[model samples]
Target: MTYVFNPTYQLLVLASAFAAVHLLASGRTFIFASHTILFAALTAVLVSHGIEPYQTTAQAPGGLWVKLFYGAAKATWWIGGALMLVSSVRLFLIFEGRPREGRLVQDLLAGLIYTGAALSIVAYVFNVPVGTLIATSGVIAVILGLALQSTLSDVFSGVALNLGRPYSVGDWIILDTGVQGRVVETNWRATHLLNGTNDLVVIPNSTLAKSQLVNQSSPDETHGVTLTVRVITSRSPTQIQQVFSTILLGGRHTLREPAPLVTMGEMDGQSIGVELAFRVADAGQIITAKNEMLDLIFRHLKAEGLALATSVPNLGVPLNITSIGSAAADPSDQHDAIRDVPLFAALTENELNLLTQGVTRKTYARGTEIIHQGEKSGALMVVTRGVVIVEKELGNSRIELNRLSPGDFFGERGLLMGAEEPGFIRALSQVSVLEITSEDLSKILHARPDLADDLGATLAARLDAEAEYGVATPSMRRPLTIAHRIRHLFQL
Candidate 1:
């Protein structure tokens, strides 16, 4: 017997079968079971109709039923294709991996699946062969691959970079191009960096693969830095060592183990330059540690009457002499002077006694202003007991030029030629000064013209060197702003 097939019924059967297959592939138990039930019902109906279109003649009794079955099958295929496309999109979103929530993967999968499904649907509707459409797609794919070779390479490279985890977002990296910045985002085509200036930079994935990159913030977030200082040649090696050790110990931010190291970096004719090497948890904290260390060192040196060198204009001949001051009677002062000040030890007892007589002693409490800029110079000050801060007032702000200690001296140039003070001098600690009166200094110059001339020339040279290549004082160095401080703390 011949059976007639209906086109609409056939289409529904095909659609049900396709949907069942799709549900199974997606591993959705409830959907798969439902599709299975629908497929079974269609299969039963097709069988009960006795529609054997493949075996019957072209003009059969159940031709309409056969057509319906075929139509159903076609409809089922389309439904399955749509379900598969949806599953692909869901997978792209749900998959837990690097470049989380990346749009590239989702776009690529959707494009491929939708294009293939849509083409197949159109071909079916027009009675075109599936083989012909697939062949055309293959040819198009080859041409597209060749045309987009560089773009494809970058896409693949981005995948590799993400999987390799060479660096991650918020990490500090130094690229081969010498660009250093924090990673902000990574995509299929490029990676974004937030630079030191807070500017965003987009770098191609291909460039990243070809260039070298240093992940400074990878493996760990903390790093290290260094600080250096210079003291007068008159300062004893032992005293300088002690001062630096004290600074490192007192500093709140410096690391302890593998403790901070102090080394004498250089010996300029009249000064010993020292470098302090220390470890800090973050590069951001380096400035804070440096400031704290400076303050501590200055205060200690002042309380001890150490003298630091100066770099400024000389007002005059600066009394042409060094005074022993009241600290001359203190054994510690005598020991420090003899050990640190070469010029003092170089003189004979009579000369030393005369030099000591010219020196007058003075004390200043902490925060007291010792000398104001523009004031007339009387005697040069040699710090024999405490600390003094040399500052220059610039409009609304006071710029600290340097800190002085026991061996540090100031006012020589101003006293010699009798010029006005070039800046202000304040005490950071209780300061003990050895003051030399201009009258006594004149007498010493007359008695020992050679000594007076040599000392004056040395002081002048020191002043010149300071002005030429002066180190930045604590206040002169820029401080980290609030935004930078927050970023450093959270590593955002």
Candidate 2:
């Protein structure tokens, strides 16, 4: 005789198992809770209809409602229990911080367990032969497989991907067919990607499994970017390398550990190609970093008198002086940047234009050392854009004296005093400054003697203020007064 279970008692035990699974599962795995609720509903229907093992719908007494409820409960109970069991296993893996990539395996195992149990119950309790049920199930499976061929392809492809583990969720990927985005979700049928434009792109698992993909976020987030530009052959390779290295080393987004590399690339008759390769903090910041690098390169070439190579009327012809400076920088911008300087405000419009003509616009990336203390370069710099920090070395650490933004000026005291730099100057951001050599200032001072007194007073007062603020001001023994130093240095 086969043993039979009381309907109410069996349901209570099954409900308790599902409830325990749901309670122990991690909150991130919502599938477990959903499947548990479904299983509980099925159990409730079976209890209400008094359906149990060995109880058949064929022997139901009177109402159609009673028979319908019994059939529905019987069909759904085993299938719902299988689903809940599979989901519970997945939740357990997730809670343990293990890979949940064996979802297909869990489903297959659950199906096998449910099928074996169903067969045993039918054979023992209802006296149905197991061989006949196997034959019937085989025929139904063949028909369903043919009808759902496309779905099977996706399922198999998804299984392959899970096993391979090419790209996971939150990874940025680029497909060969030009679809680039962050992977948001991967289901059995399709993978959904969220793109830079904030749109969702859904690709079928079968299609993705066959396509070529580049994972930007695999291994690490550090992304390498290369930029190439052709510079005229007039500039030496050493000068070009120095300019490129400075730009890369001080870049805000660039990684310093790998240390950016600058190499001389292909060379033609008129120009030589230069390449700058560097790694940024992450792949997402590449676009912003590339744009900033281009701006810095353009300005640096202009400052160093290196012009970008362009197509000439004759392939082997050299560029003229006028054509060289044309693309190097905009003369109008240089003039405007010069006029905005307060030290030059004492000069007339014509004098300002003359000074602007002599000025060179230099670009410095963030963290670049613009001027070092005790360096003998007496060039005056006027900030046109971005920011810089002024500091002096005190013992081991450097003391920050001030921050200079756009329209601020520095290094004028060095020019007037005829001495080395007093403090260290560093670029705090991508900075552009108009630099005027002392030679250029000397010419303007010779033209107007009265301008010397005004500039000297300004420079001396600035020196005294910086000294008061703990910045090391260089002491040079030369002139009795600030005005004398300005006059003697400018040759007035």
Q: Which one is best on lDDT?
A: 2
- Name every residue pair that clashes in candidate 2: none
RMSD of 1: 18.6
| Decoy 1 TM-score against native | 0.42
Model 1 lDDT, residue 393, Cα:
73
The TM-score, computed over Cα atoms with residue i paired to residue i, of candidate 2 is 0.58
Local accuracy by lDDT, each model: 0.61, 0.70
Q: Across residues 185-268, which tens digit of lDDT does each residue of candidate 1 receive?
A: 888899998886789999989889888998877567765566665566556777777666655554556676667888877665
Q: What is the lDDT of residue 390 in candidate 1?
A: 70
| lDDT over C-alpha atoms for residue 180 of model 1 | 75
Q: Give candidate 2's root-mean-square deviation (CA, Å).
A: 11.9
Q: Which tens-of-lDDT digit does each residue in 126-240 have in candidate 2? A: 4578899889899899999999999988988987887698987778899999999988877778888998888999999999999999999888878899999888777678877
Each candidate's TM vs. the true structure? 0.42, 0.58
Which residue runs does candidate 2 get wrong by more than 4 Å?
A: 1-84, 95-127, 311-492
For model 2, what is the C-alpha lDDT against the true structure? 0.70
